[model samples]
Target chain A: MHRIGDAPKVRRALVSAAVILSALFLLLPLVAIFAQAFSAGADVFWRNITQPDTLSAIGLTLFITVLTIPVNLVFGVALAWLVTRFRFPGRRLLQTLIDIPFAVSPVVAGLVYLLLYGRNGWIGGWLDTHDIQLMFAWPGILMVTIFVTCPFVARELIPLMQAQGSRDEEAAVTLGASGWTLFRRVTLPNIRWALLYGVILTNARAVGEFGAVSVVSGAIRGQTNTLPLHVELLYQDYNTVGAFASASLLALIALLTLATKAGLEWRAARREA
Target chain B: MSIRLKNIAKTYGKAGRGVSRALEPLDLDIHEGELIGLLGPSGSGKTTLLRIIAGLEAADTMSDRPSSIHFGDRDVTHLHVRDRRIGFVFQHYALFMHMSVFDNVAFGLTALPRKQRPSSGEIRARVQRLLEMVQLESLANRYPAQLSGGQQQRVSLARALALRPDVLLLDEPFGALDAKVRQELRRWLRHLHDELNFTSVFVTHDQEEALELSDRVVVMSNGRIEQIDSPEVLYRSPANRFVFEFLGDVNRLEGHVHDGTLTCGDARLDVDLDEGSHELLLRPHEIKLDEHPTELAHLPVTITAIAPVGAEVRVELEADWLAEPWLATIRHADFERLRIKRGQRLYAIPRQWHQFPAANQRSIASETMS
Candidate 1:
C-alpha cells in the first residue's frame, strides 16, 4: 500500500492541475488582448497606433524611459555601494528609506509630488516666481516617473553587493588601484548583470506606469499623456478597437520585458555555474 | 621591505556593553627578505594581525597607546592599502570572475597613473613573465571559473607579485586545496619567496605548513603571540605548554612528586622534582617500549594497536594511570625485532620528559630517564 502523498500518479496529477490553472489565469488575458487587437485587421491596428496623438504618447513613454533609466542607474549603483560597503550612523535607516518608493502606491506618490512641486504648492510658489511650470507639464511627468522607478536597480544590487562582501575590492585596493580604477576594474564588472536586470525592470515599470503619471500629466492631448494615459483616453472615447490596439502595444512591451528577463536570468545562472 | 608593528590592538563593539576584544596590544619587527608564518588556531588573531599589517583593518587607538606601522622608513599606519604598496592573497582566491588570467595579472600594472604607467606592450610582457613564473602561462586566456582551485591560487600569486609590492601577505594561501595540491603549492610558494627576495608574511593554522615553509614561525594563541622562533627551535624547545601542544601531539603524565619519585595510582616514575603535584609532557618518539619494567620512568601498559607504515611503526598503549591513551612511534626495525602485537603487555619508558608548572609558564624544567 502506497502513502497518499507518495503516490507518483497523484502527485503528477496535482502538479499538472496547479500549473495548468495558473498558466490559464496568467495567459488568458494576454491572449485576449492580442486577439482583439488584430480582430479588425492590420490596417485598423496600424491606423490606431499611428494616430498623431498615439505616436506622441509612444514618444513620451520612450522619452521618460530613456531619461529616467540612466539617472536611476547611476543613483542605484551609488546607493548600493554606499549602503553595502560603508559603516556609518543611520545606515539602516537609509537602506530602509530606499525601498519606500516601491512600497508606496503610485497614485499616492504622484499626489505627494504634486503637493510639493505643483504650481500653488510648497516649492510651487518659488518655481512660479521663476516662471517655471512643473505641474501638469513634461517635467512633472518626468518627476513622477523617476519616483516610480527609483528603487528597482538599487533593490537588485544592494543584497548581491552585500553578499559578495568587500574581499575583491580590498584585493584590488592593495594592488595599488586608485578608487576609480577599483570601481571600474573590480566592482562594475561584478555587478554588471544585476545592474542590467534592474534597468530592464525599471524600463518596463516606467513604460507601463498609469496611475502616477495620470495624476500629474493633466492628460493634454499630444502634450504630456504617456502611452497608458492615451490608452485610457481612447477607451473613454468608446473607440474599442483603438483602445485595445494601444493596450496591445503595452502588452507587447510587457511580453518582451518578460522574455528579456528570462534570458538574463538564464545567463546569470550559467555564469554562476 | 622590513616591517614593524608597534602597540597594535583591535576591539569590537562598545566598551560597557556587548563587546569582544579581538586583539590585545602587540609589537613585532620583521626583517627584510624574510618569510614569516603567523601560526595559530581559529580565533587566535593570526589573520587579524596580518590584515592590520596589510592595512585592510585599522589597529585600535588609545590615549596612552598609539598604534603605528612602518614599512622600512615609511610610516604607513594611516596610509591606504593602495598607497602602502602591499599585496594580499586571500584564502579564497578573489580573482576577477569576468577577466581572463592574463587580464587579472595585468590589473595592477594597467591601473597605474598615466605618467607612471607602463605601455600596453610592456604591461602584457610583464604579465606574461609573471604568469610564466607561476607556471600558468598556458591558461592565460581562461577565466577564473575555468581553472581548478590550485590553478586559480597560482594565478592569484602571479597577480600579487606583478606589482612588485614591498610586502606580500597571504592568508592561508593553500587552505582551500586538497592535501596533495596543498603540498605542491607550499613548495611553489617557498621557491617564489626565495627567488624574488621580498618580505612576506603568511597566516595559517596548520602546524606543518608553518614549520615546513617559514624561515621563522610566530606561534599565536588567544590574540597573543606565544613565541617567535625558527621551526626547528620551536619544535624542540616550545616556549610554553600551549606551543608544545599546538605544534604536535603530546602525551601527559600527571602525579604527585615526593622526594625524587612521582606516584599516581599504580604507576611510579623517577623524576627530579620537589615534593608537589607535577605534570610531565613527552613527544611520541621520546617514549621507549620494552618487555621488562625498568628502574627509570617506566609504566606497565597493554598494546592496544600497532600501525606500521613506511619507516616507522606507531604503537598505541593504554594503562590505568593514563588519562588518555599514549602513542609511541618506533622504528620499523625495532617493530620487527620486538614483534609487537595487539593485546600484548608492555612497559613504556619515557626517555625524557618536560615539565611546566602551569599552562602559560615559559621555563621548561626537564628530566632524563636512565
Candidate 2:
C-alpha cells in the first residue's frame, strides 16, 4: 500500500520544487527594489512620503484600483454566467473573446482604448468637442486597467460555475420558486464562494496592472501616475530611496494578496470539513 | 391526484441527425399517495417517465392529450417544473455545496411568495422537524460536504420533503451507496413511506430493492412494462417469463405442450395451454433432489457443478432424457446432509410446473435479455 502511493510523494516533491523556483524567480525583482529602497537613509524615505505629488500618485492609484476591480467583477461574473449557463449563437467566439484580454499585451490593450477613447479617437473626439475629457485623466487610467484585468474574475468563475451546475435552480423551480428567488436563494449561495474568489483575483490583478495604464495614462505627476509608474518616474529622476520605498509598499500589498487568497481557501476547506 | 400518460413518448435530434427515441408511445396511470417503483435496467426509459411526471420533460404527444395529469383539480401536464410542486432526489444528492444542511432544506421553503414565507423562527422549526424526520437533526448546522454519503442523502431526503411536495420523485436514491448503507436506508425509506405516504415514484435496477421497498414494483424491459405487482405476487405468480427470470433465479425446461399438459425435459406436467409450441417454468428453490419419486417420477441426472453461496448451495444438473439444464438450491446443512458432490449422478424432482402461455412466452425472447 505504501509502495503504491510513493509515486504521489515524488510528484509532490517535483511540483513543490517547481513552485518554489518559479516564485523566487518572479519575486526577486520586487525584492531587489525593496532592498534598494532600504539602501538609503531614513531622511530620504521621509522626503519620498511627504512629497505632495507622491502622496497624490499613491492616492490616485488606490482609488483607480478600487474603482476598476468591482467593474471587472461585474463584467466578469456576467460574462461567466453568459458563457457557462447559456448556449447561443457565437457562444464559442464570445468565450474566446472574454479571454482575449488575458493573452493581449497590456500596451496593446492601451492602444485599443486609445483608438476608441483617445482625445483624437472615435468617442473621444465627440466627447472632447463638448469639453468632456476622458484621456489624460483618472477615468482614462481606470478604463485601461479595466480592459487589462477584465478576464481575471471571469477566468476564476467560468470553471466553477460550469461544475457547480444549474441543477439547484431547476430544483428550486420545481419547488415553485420564481426567477429572482431561485437565483438569490439557490444559485447565488452556491456560487458565493467562487464569486468571492473571483473578486479577490480581480482585485489583485487590477491593483498590480502597469503597462496598459502607462500608455493610457498621460503620466501627469500628481494626477494620472499610478504607484508602478510613479516608482519608474522617481527612479528615472534619481530619487532611488523614494522609488524603492513605494516599490516595497506595492510588494507588501502583493504578498498580502497571495497570503489572503491562500488563507481564504484553507479556511474554506476547514469549514467544509 | 392522478397522473394519466396517454401515448407519451420522447425523441431526440432532428430528422437529418438521425432520430433517437428516449421513450416510446406508452400509457400509464399513477394514483396519489402511492409508492410506485419503476424497475428497469439502464436506458429503459423509466427515468424518462418519471421526468415527464415531474414536468422536467415534455412528451411529443402529451400536449395532444388535453387531459394527462390531474393533480386534484388542476391540469399540470403542460406546466413547467416550477409549477409541478414535485420534489426530486437526484442520485448524487445535488445538495448545494455552500449551504449548511438546514439552509439546503430551507431553500425550497424560502421560495414561497413573500407573504407566504414562514417566519424565520417558523422556518427554523420546520427545518429542524424535517431533519428529525430523516434523523439528521444533529447534522443540521453542518454543510453537505462535511457529511458522509449516507448523511448527505438523508439531508437531501429532508430537503426534498421540506416543501411538502405534491409528488416526490427519486432517481435511484440509494444507487450510489455501499451495500450496508443501501440496506439501512432502504428500511428507513420504507418506514418514511408508510408514515407520510406522499405520492412517490422511484426508478431502480435492483430487483430485491424494488421488491422489498415498493408497494408495487413495475418491471420494465426495453422501455416497456413487463409486470406490475406486489413482491409476493410477483415472486409466486409472474405475469410473464421476463418477470419470472428478472425477479429471481429460474430454470427453463424446453418442450411442447398439448391438451393442457407439457412434457418438459424429463418431467411430465400439467399446464395451461392455448396453442403453438410451449414451455414450462421452474424456480431453483421449487425443485428438490430425491433418490425416489414421492408423487412425481424422479429424473436421474448428472450433477454437473455445485456452487456454495454463503448459506446455500446451487446444484446444476442435466437429465439424460432431456435436452435442457436443471438447477436446484439447498441449504448448506441440507446440501451436507445429502452429501452432494460434483459430477455425481442424482435425481431431480420439480414440485410444480408453471405454465408458459403465449403472453408469457412472448416475454421469453426478452428473458434472454434479462
Candidate 3:
C-alpha cells in the first residue's frame, strides 16, 4: 500500500524539484565564489589575500570573533540556566527580552548602541570626558558583533535544558555535591552537547556578522574594516578577484561550520542508538 | 536516623493571585530504621511532603508556629540539602545520562570535599559493592540511556545509598516500572532497607505497594494526613471515609434506613442503624455472591465482567441500585464452585459493612452480618 504523497511519479517529481532547486540556488553561489576568485589565476588571488588592508581586516575579524564568543558563552549559559531552573516574578518577561537581539534588525541594534555610546550621544559625551573611545573603533565593532550573536547560544540551550529539567541537579545537591561541583559534574555533563552546539552557532554568527559591524566600524581601511566590509571596499574599487577571494574565505568558514555541525549530530545520534 | 516534622506547610505561588495550598500544617514522627509510605491519589501532596523533607522545598513559616524539621537531635529546618546529609531518588530516576553506572554511583562519594573525600580505591570498592547489591555489577560500564527502566532505577537507588546519608527519600520509586519489575524492585528495596538499617520514606499512589513495603503507611488527601498506622492496622481499621476509600476498592450503599431495614431502589438489607438516611461501605472481599436472595440482603446484581487472571477472580457486579459498578473478589475455588460467568444474575450478600455518619460527626461503626 502506498502512503500519502508516496505515488512513484509524484515522489520522483518532488525529489527532483528539491534537488534541482538546492543545486541552483545554494550550491551554485558557493562554487561561483571560488571559481571567480581563481579566474585570474592563483598568483593574483594570493596577492589579493596578502594585501596589507586585507591582512588587517582578517586580523580584526578574528579578534572580534574571539572576544565575542567567550563573552556570549558565559552570558548565554547564565541566562539559560536562570530562565530554566528558577521561578522569579519577571521570568516570562526576561525570556521575551532574550529574543530582542533576534527580533530587531541587526543594523537597528547597531544604531541603538551608537546612539547610546557614540560621540555626541548621551553616555558617549560622559565617556568623551574620560577620553574612552568606543564607537568608530575596534571596541565598537566587537560590541555590535556581540549584540548580533548574543541569542544563538541561549536560544539553542533554553528549550533543551527545559526539556531535561532540574531533577539531576536536585539529585546532585541531595547527594552532598556543592554548588560548583554540581554544576561541573552533573549539570555540565548533561548539557555539554547542547552547549557545544550553541557555541558552534554563536561562533558562526560572530564570524559572519556584517550588518551590525558595518554600521558601527566606520570602515576605516586597515583599522576597523573587517573581512565583509573589506570585501565590499574591494568590490567598489573594481577589484573583482580580490572581493571574490575574501568571499571564498567566508564561504570556507561557513562550510567548515556546517560540516562540524553535521559531525556532532551524527555522533549524538549514534550515541543515542 | 529518626525524623521529626513540626507544623510543616506549603503554599505555592505568590500571595493574592494564583496562590494554592499544597500542604497543610502537620506534624509527624518517624522511628529510626522505619520504612514509611506516603499513600495518596494525584494532587494529594504526598510528593510535596517528601520533597519538603528532602530540603528540595521549604515549608511555609506560620507566624504563630514556626515550621521545623529534625533528624535525630539535629535541627535541620534551615539546613541546605547538601549539608543535611540526605539522599533523594527522583521518580524518573534522574541518573546522570553521560556517566557510566559505576560513575553515577560513585558521584556522591567523589564529590565530597577533599578533606572528607574517600580514596579512589575505597570509592571503587564501595561502588562495586553497591552494584553487586543491586545485581548490576556486570552492567557498570553502561550509560543510563543504554539501560532499561528497572536498571536505571537500581542505579539511582545505589547512587542515593552511596553517600551513606542518614535518611533516604524516594518519590514514587517504582511508579515508572512495569508491574513485574515494580514487584521485584519493591521486594529488593525492602530487603536492602532491612539489611542496611537506614530510615527511608517513599511516596506512592499504588495501595498494594504501600501496604506491602511500608512498616507504616501515612494515608493523605486534600493536603492533610487522614491516618498513620501499620499496613495491617491501616487495612483493618481506616480512620475516615477518605482513608477507607483511598486504601482499596470500596462499594457504596446509599439509601434510607427505616425500622432496621435499609432500602435503595429495589434493593433492601437488614442493617442495624437509626431510622434516617445512611450510607454503608463494603470491601470487595466482604461481599459474597449467592444464587438465592439471603434473609439479611436482597442486593440483586448481574455479573457485568469477569477477570480471572490473578490468584483471585474479580467479578464486576452492576444493579439498578448502584450509581457505579461494584467489584467482588472471590477465591478460585469459590469461582469454580459457582461457575460464575458474565451476564449471570446473582444476589450479593454483605458479610461485613462500615458506616460513617454525616458531616460534623466523625466516627466509624462496623457491623457483621449474623
Candidate 4:
C-alpha cells in the first residue's frame, strides 16, 4: 500500500535534509547578519545606522523604490491585460520581451542604459548640452533600479491573469459596464492579490539591487549611493559592523516581503477553496 | 428585440497565410421574444454567430455587400457590446468571485452612468427580485466560491437579468452542470425566457437540451446552418443527412440495391431503391425485433447488449452484414414480451427508414411501415 517515496525512512531523510539545507543556506545567513551587526554592541550598530551618509542612502533607496513600484505596477497590469485579453500580431514577442529584464544581467542592462544615455553615449550627448545629468547621479541610480525590478509585477500577474481569463471582464461589458468601470470593478478585484504580491517583489528587488545601481550611480556618498551600494562602500572601507548593519536592514525588508507574500498566498488559497 | 443579421461572417487569420473561415456570410432573422437554440457540435460557428449578434465580435464586411446587425429598429453593427444593451451568460458562469450573489446581481445597475443609474435602494430591490426569480434569495449573501455549480449558474442568470436587457445570449449555459441540474436549469431558463419575453439565444451541443428547450433550433455544422425548425418538425423531418445524424442516434444500412431489394452479406431487406450502392438511415426506435425472420426483412442479428433503462429498453444488435453495431429501442412491455437477452439471435425489421442520396443530398426520402 506504500506510495512512491512514502517509506517512513525515506520521508524522514528527505524532510531532515531539506530542513538542514534551509538552515545552512537561508536561516543561518539571516541570523549571522543581525549577529555581526550587533557584535560591537547596540551603540555602534545605532551609530552606523544614524550616520549622515547611511541616512541619505536609506532615503534615496526608499525614494527610488516608491517611484519604481507604481511605475512597474501600472506597466505590469497593462502588459498583462494587453497580452492576455487580446489577440494581435507580435503578442508572443511582446510577452517574451517583458522577460528581458529577468533574462539580461542587471549590470548589462545598466551598461546599455549608460551607453544610450551617458554623456559620451547616443542620447546623452544631446542631454548634456541641456545640462541633464542622468548617469553618475540619483536619476541614473533610479533608472537602473527600475530596469532590474520592472519584470516582477508583470511576471507575477501574467500567468495568473491568463489562467483566470477574460470571461469576467467580457461579462461585465455585455452587462453595460464601460471600460473603466469593468476594469475597476471586475478586473482589479480579480488581480489585486497578484498585483500586491508583484509590488512587494518589485519593492524587495528595488531596495536590494546593487550590481546595476553601482554601474550607473558611481556610488557618490550621500548623493547617489543606494543602501546596497552604501553597504559595499562601508565594507570596502574595512567597516564590517557597518556593512552588516546595512545588510540587516535589507534582511528585515526581505523578511517582511516574504511574510507578506506568504500571507497573500494563504488568503488566496483559502478564497479559492 | 427582433435580431436581424445580414451577411455576417468571421475569418480567424490574416488573408495571406492560411486564413481559416469560422463562419460564412449568411443572413438570419430571429423574431422578438423567441428562444432560439444554436445547436451544433464543437467548432460549428454557433458561438461565433451568437457573439456577432451580441456585438462581442465584429462580423467581417464583404466587398460587395457589407455585413450588418440590427436589434429591433436600431442598427447595431458598429455598436460596442456595452452600448448594445445585451446580457451574456458565459459557459462557466463568470460570476464575480469577490462579490456576494447580491452584489454580483447589482453590478450592472451600479455600473450605469450617474445620470441613468438607479438609486441604491432601487438597485438592491431589483437584485433581490432577480435572486428571488432564480430561487437563490437565501444564498444572496454568499460569495460565488461558496455556492455549488448550479447555484453559481443561477447567480450568473440573476446578474444577466439585472440589466433587463432586450436580448440575452448564453454560451453553453448549462454545459458544466450535472445531468439532473442541467435539466432543472434548462426548465428554469425556459420559464424565465417565457416570462421575461426577451429575444434569447443559447448555444449547446446537446441535442436533447436544444430539442427540449428551444422554440426553434438552428442546427449547424461546418460553419453552416443545416436546418432551422421547431423541435417537432426537426425531429420528424430533418433537412439533410447532417441534420438527421446530428439530431439523434442514427443506424446506417449500407448495401447494394437491385430489383427492389438491398443486400449486405446474408441479410436482405426489401428496398425500393435504384440499382446502385445506397445507404439508409434508421432511428433506434424505428427498429423492431422478433424471434423469427419476417418475409419483408430477413435481416438476422445477434443481441449483443441490452440496456433496460428509463421508459424503454435499448438492445444492441450485431450481424455479419453490419459493419458496426446497430441499436434498437423498444418499449418495456415489448422487451418483456420478447424476453430478449445477450447472445440471443433475432430478426430486425425496419419499421421506417430515411435516405439522403449522395448527389443532391438536401432532399430526403422517408418510408414508413405500411
By TM-score, the best candidate is 3
Clashing pairs in 4: none
Model 2: residues with Cα > 4 Å off, grouped in runs: A1-28, A86-93, A119-136, A166-173, A176-189, B13-15, B57-68, B96-103, B135-151, B224-244, B250-282, B290-312, B316-327, B331-337, B347-370
- Residues A35-69 of candidate 3 have per-residue lDDT tens digits of 99999999999999999999999999889989999
User: CA lDDT of each candidate?
Assistant: 0.91, 0.79, 0.92, 0.90
Report how closely model 3 matches the true complex, as a DockQ value: 0.85
- What TM-score is obtained for chain B in each of the predicted models? 0.97, 0.85, 0.96, 0.97
Q: List model 1 lDDT by residue over B298-349, tens digit each.
A: 6888899988867888899999999999999999877877788899888888
For each prediction, how big is the interface RMSD?
A: 0.7, 1.5, 0.8, 0.7
TM-score of 1: 0.94
What would the per-residue lDDT of candidate 1 be over residues A80-115, giving only the tens digit for each residue? 999999998899999999988889999999998889
lDDT score at residue B103, model 3, on the 0-100 scale: 96
lDDT of 2 at B84: 81
Query: Interface RMSD computed for candidate 4 is what?
Result: 0.7
Highest lDDT, which number? Answer: 3
Residues B1-370, candidate 3, lDDT per residue (tens digit)? 9999999999998887898889989999999999999999998899999999999999998899999999999999999988898989888999998889999999999999999999999999999999999999999999888899999999999999998899999999998999999999999999999999999999999999999999999998889988899999888877788888888889999999999999999999998888989889999999998888878799999999999867998999999999999999998998888889899999999989987675323446555564
Q: List model 2 lDDT by residue over A1-273, tens digit each.
A: 467437987979988998899779886787787777777767777678778988998898889888987788788878888898886779899988987888889999888888888888999999989998887888888888888778888888899889877777766777788888876777777677777887777777777778888898888998889888998898999888888888887888888888988988997899676
**Deviating ranges (above 4 Å) for candidate 1:** A1-12, A15-23, A269-273, B359-361
Better of 2 and 3 by TM-score: 3
